[model samples]
Target chain A: MNTVSTSPYLAGLLQGQPPASPLTWLNELRANAVDRVGALTVPTTRDEDWRFTDISPLTKLSFQPAQGAAQLAPAAIEQWAIPEAAARLVFVDGIYAPGHSFNRAGLTVENLASGVSRHGAAVQAHLGRYADFERNVFTAVNTAFLHDGALILVPRDTALAAPVHLLFIATRKHAASYPRCLIVAESGSAVTVVEDYVALQSEAYFTSAVTELALTGNAEVHHVRVQREGAEAFHFANCAVSLAQASRYHSVSIALGGRISRHNLAALLAAEGAECRLDGLALIGGQQLADSHTLIDHASPRGSSRQLHKCIVDGAARAVFNGNIMVRPGAQRTDSSQSSRNLLLSARARVDTKPQLEIFADDVKCAHGATVGQLDVDEVFYLKSRGLSDTAARNLLTYAFGAEVIERIPVASLRNRLEQTVMERTHAAAPGAEGKP
Target chain B: MIYQDSKTLLSVRDLHASVSGTRILKGMNLTVKSGEVHAIMGPNGSGKSTFAKVLAGHPSYEVSGGEIEFEGRNLLELAAEARARAGVFLGFQYPIEIPGVANSQFLRLAYNTVQAGRGEDELDPLEFDDFVREKMKLLEMNPDFLDRSVNEGFSGGEKKRNEILQMALLEPRLAILDETDSGLDIDALRIVAGGVNQLANKDNAIVLVTHYQRLLNYIVPDYVHVMDAGRIVKTGGKELALELEERGYDWVGAEAKANARVNA
Candidate 1:
């Protein structure tokens, strides 16, 4: 168990002490990752993925090591908790809130800090294995100060009846929330995890988070990320997943808020006959900006990956979508597809899309496509003629655009919650609530 | 009021329109007053549908030389949505399928847009649901149809009924039923025609554009105009539709070619 403290350095030292000689390599890796975070500059308008989205808001924040010491008002975390989750982990200002958590059998949900302090071997072995810190600065930073995340471990052949919910709340006082998560499903295990990051208040803050997931052979895993930060909040999150032979992985990311936000996800099909699906939907309004970049690597033969990402941009908001699929050599019969679509609701709204495919294997079926467009007038007319007002019609069309991704989500309740979030965000972006449900 | 019973709902004089540099409606002329139902009967490619689309301000159709007035206001000046707001509705021959737009939500937006254009407050979802439920009843449409996406996965009959449901809700001053019967089965035609009849008040006019006189049997028009070679060659009463159906379109075409030769 971790001793709660306000000093970030003391908290870091108490949390970072390695257990024994056997775990020295991982501790060293964590130190190196921290150095990388310090060396590498946070992305700005200069980077391709960060072009349309400005990180100036993030750079202005004086990020502190949030040591899970801040107290949240009664019933605050409950308002954002997933009601049907079998197990729930709540984090307030990047620190675990033990009193707000729900317990479950055959499942262990602990803060990364405590996991490192207690279950050091298990925590250190798989903490940063899946995530590639070299490719992303935020991931490196998360690894360096990876003390505030939730670790979920599902033992072999355990099929959880309900999803595990992880809630991270970024409050105005905390100013910054750095969240790191690790979910490992052993062979033949089945589990669903919903990771939600929300702003507790409408104030300027930053959330830098990382989630690393692994699926052993034949394990089925479902993961969903719902980011509903405040209008003045800056959010950066990355998820890296590794799939073993015959394992199935389904992941969906919904980014609908924040002033400046970025989501980077990478899925590696490491063994033969693995299945990976990455789906995302984003709704942006006001002067908000959101950037999403994804990569699906077919590292072995007989692997399949499908990626679909959709964005709705309204007001003067901006969005950027980058999807890439890599088919390495000898990865035969690798069926992979990637598509990114953007619908601009306002004339001032803008979207930049890039879909690329690199296929080194000749026997692979790989395709990538990207499209950016305004709502089709004819399509709008079709709806308006049915007696919907212009604003209502546009909102319906926008919801429908994002629904394609929401429908693919395995959990119905989470999907419904996300639908409401998307509708609310869209209404805020649009002129009126004429068509909102 | 969105309509005046004694005034002309639609008036076109020497109207010309083209798409992609190809002329479609060449000097077409027509007029319809509120409370009147007029059917424009013509063969394919005779510009019957173009007249309807141009009146609705389809983006691709260029109104090169035309004067269109609806209830004394210049129709050609309004954009498609403005025209819609100004009480002009066009039932597309091929209704586009908008994948994500719900059938119910689309109807509400259209109704509210028209209301807002007429200087009225917009209806919220709760109010619009009641409004649409009442209209759907007249069309004999199931309540579930409102939850589906616009025109997506709809059968031919369902699409036609959906169009009529829209016409009933918006209550346009002049409803251009462009090939509304093109892809309907007998059951769909009856339901669609029934819906039109329920909404057809004495204050609004209807313009039915079709190639066949089949739909005329369900909803008889007050007048019928025979168009050929981009121009109307003849106009008569409802009996004209029966006559054209019995005699075929050769007589109208022959007369049109004769007029073209004389003009040339």
Candidate 2:
């Protein structure tokens, strides 16, 4: 880790007075966050949590908050939108672009800044409650710039007919944007939210994003985030979720972009019988590096969770996956399983996956495993024997390895879109890098 | 060597091959014309499987010095996929498991590739699904196999049937079966052989590479060739297979040694 990127404070991001807000409480919340950002620094290699990922590039630059939504041609973002989404929100450069967004009935989807403008007490109770900024600096940065993002709330007993797609587009060079999202699913409600991050060009930018999801009793949420930023961009994202009694949460994070990207995913099971499934897939190649750090905390009795995180490394790229499942005291009857499957496509591509289970509850069923491998030679031979070229065979096999985890997503349209993305990318999941056609 | 004709589908002359610096096929020779069924029988380590893989241009074995002609073209110069596109098929003894690619997708890609190579119209997914289902009935393979991954969880017999299914779909001019009947039960053998029999015509040829004569009883061969120490020592009619089965292979090995010494 370089010393410059590891520094704790980055100046000149505040610009001016916090924001023009009617609510003093929200303004005070933002004020406290700026103070927190000044105190908490970027996690360094000495920090056990960030041992494998180096954020030196992030420390060297000072970024200004993106100005406003820029007008892009219609055809650019149309490819990323699925018609199946009931409500679609488009944010260009971390600011909502109304011209490119759509919303359906029976659901409330508004910009975070708009939600704060109305000054409703309901938004006040849920916002910033699930994410903690005492230890994480990125969360504080997002909180300091919390006037914009996607604000969603699902009412009780309403099962959404279609998902809400939040599309975040990063553009411009040497600019920084803090994208925040708050999803509060009321009791007995079911919803799915997709966070899609894309880039139109290979210009360098910084996207410090945070999302807080709170699921009440008997609520269900399926959260999927796709990160496909440009190869030169930087992405730092954190998702903190809390589940109530009998609530279920499932999340799949696909990271496939940026020069240096790290996703911090943590879930808390706070009530009995709450179930969760945490899955992730990262595709890194060239000189890029992506890291996924996950923590699942079981605080109540009879809670269960299952996790499978996988990464495919190609070229000289590197990937890191750290998954920890904790069964706290008095959390009996906890059933959790975690596995990390890493595939190395070249001699230089590498992965560091650590699956840990810290159990304080004596009577619990917990299992964790980790594996790193390459494509099977016999399988490749078989594909080649059937008239497939060497490159096609290797690509097909590499796509399948990622598909094993991606196919777990139940939504057909979402699953198919992701399948297309993985297939279209480079098939560097084979051993040798030289002489590949 | 068998006499070559205008109807010849494959012609092999003085073929030599080795793997990892060790010679496996040394000056082996054979010739097969369309409409003919030839069976090559040999004991362990005689390179019957190696010859089949070499025909399909497997990357493992290098043709040190030899010649292989298929369909009036030099076979060794083509890549494995190019050979498949040019109508050469090899049935592996051990089918590999591909865990996530659907069987139907695999079959269609191969079928369309060969069709494209021949300048024929390619079938779309829906059309290929119907065509593949019809072919599946010949092997009694369940329709569910189309949705599952290729040979991932299939039984040993099912894997062989899949190989034959590919052979049937591609409609290769020369089909080589390497121990396809090694692990099949009696019933499976009849079904698979029956499928093979239906596929044989005057436009293509079939080569059965096997260890036991039991398979020959189902799909009788026109010529039976005895391979020993990487060379064909004897070539006779189909009845020669039964004779070898009865008399065993030691006498044949000894006779070849005696003949070699006499020639020297």
Candidate 3:
């Protein structure tokens, strides 16, 4: 394999790394990731995996690693606080902010820096194992700088009544932040986790995040990820999930910000009778671009998976969705269905959607469908005939298109906040507001 | 009932319209006065539904040549929503299914929009809920429908009732019902027609565009006009609907053609 040439852009991003961790395995993991980053180059349109999403804008600008955590007041982040969260961990610029965080769940929910010292074996066994960075430059870069992250471990047969919130806030421009998260749900345990990313300013920045989730036998994990970066930010995230026997994983990811953002999620049903449900929504406007790639691997018998992804693009924006479902040769009775629905609100808006299925097992059932369209003319006229203006009708339909996916989010307060945000974004991108009749 | 002294609500003169460059309405002319119900009967492609859509200013239909005056103003200048706000309502033949938008929310918006247009007080959600629940009783709609998406997964009868429910909420000065009886059972037809009858008054007019006389039996019309090809070809009283229903529409088309040849 050719592992010699690394682009100057990748070299520039590898500038300021934190000192080596005291843990030997952790340091070794970082060293391997740095070598991998040196081997992989930035992906371009020529790459089959990134044929539609061009990240040249991210490589055009140079970003430095964040120096220190920003001192933030608890009141500043009060708006994003979840009342139903049993524990909360706040990270500013990829560094844990102890002043704005609290842990009351009596579980192992803390910063990875300290959690590693306490639970080194569990962290070492699962950290760099699931999210493989052999060919993924973004994931390699994230792993190379994975010093601070959120770590949660649910004990066996324990069920938490409330969710755990992991909030990452970006407060500086021209700064590169690698946000990492690793959650381990033991056998028969149940937990909900929210990995949220938000920005305080509208300036160019870079965020490469990697998250790994491991569900043990009969364990249930509800993952809700929200990426609300600034309008001029670049965000790339990789999430890997492994489901054991009879485990259930439900994930809902919403992308509403970032000038260019891409999220890659891979879920492996490694044991029999495992189930997963993946729901996603991207509501973008004003020249923004969002891409989502997901892979569901049915490695064992009786594994079932369902996925529904939607995108509402307006004002010259573009959205892309690629979903892949694979049923292995010996995986009998592996049922899977996936749908990618996109709505273009303006004439210049565009969407690239593909829902693919690869089934090798004769007894497996798999179905996939993709649709890219604009607001239905009949639906718009139906609303207008009820005395709603053209703008109101268009905005309402756009909001409804996204609400279907947002409703799947398990948290009530978060769901309400996202619903409100979707409504406001649709109105702001309306033709009437833009002075177009 | 036709009152001679009633004010004229709508006057159309040589209204010509088309869809996708194919003319559907060919020089249609009609005049509607308040406190009167006019039934425009015709075959499937006779432009009855096209007339209703044109009146509502549907974007698909292009008005190539026409003059539409409503309340002594140029009606064609206003948009669909503007026309709706100005007291013109079109009950669609196929009630649209708007998923994710609750029925209560849609009804409240339409009601408040027309209310605002008339410089009247608008009701808040709580007040609107109470007011709309009373109106729903007129159509015998279940209260659970208010929470469901607008017309989504609704039965044929339920969709028809929802359309009439909107008619009750808006209380428009002119309502053109286009084939509203096509997908309804006898019980639903009676309920929908009863709701329409309650909404009628001396200040408003109703136009029923239908293919059958079954709807005319419930909400009787003062004038029944037979339309063929595009324009109205024959005019008579309410009995004309029964006559055409019994004799079929071929005779009327032949008689109109014979008359056209004589005039030529």
Please write out the lDDT profile of model 2 over residues A228-250, one tens digit for every residue: 99888889998999999999999
* lDDT by residue for model 1 (A178-258), tens: 788989899999999989888768877778788988899999999988888888887888888999999999998888878
DockQ rank order: 3, 2, 1
Question: Which candidate number maximizes lDDT?
Answer: 3
Error of 2 at A306 (Å): 4.4
Q: lDDT of all the models against the reference?
A: 0.80, 0.85, 0.91
Top candidate (TM-score): 3
Q: Against the true structure, what is each candidate's TM-score? A: 0.82, 0.83, 0.92
What is the lDDT ranking, best to worst? 3, 2, 1
Candidate 1 displacement at residue A378 in angstroms: 1.9
Interface RMSD list for the candidates: 3.2, 4.3, 4.3
Q: In candidate 3, residue A332 scores what lDDT?
A: 99
For residue A349, model 3's alpha carbon misses the true position, in angstroms, by 3.3
Give model 1's TM-score versus the native structure.
0.82
The window of 10 residues in a row where model 1 chain A has the poorest summed lDDT is: A13-22
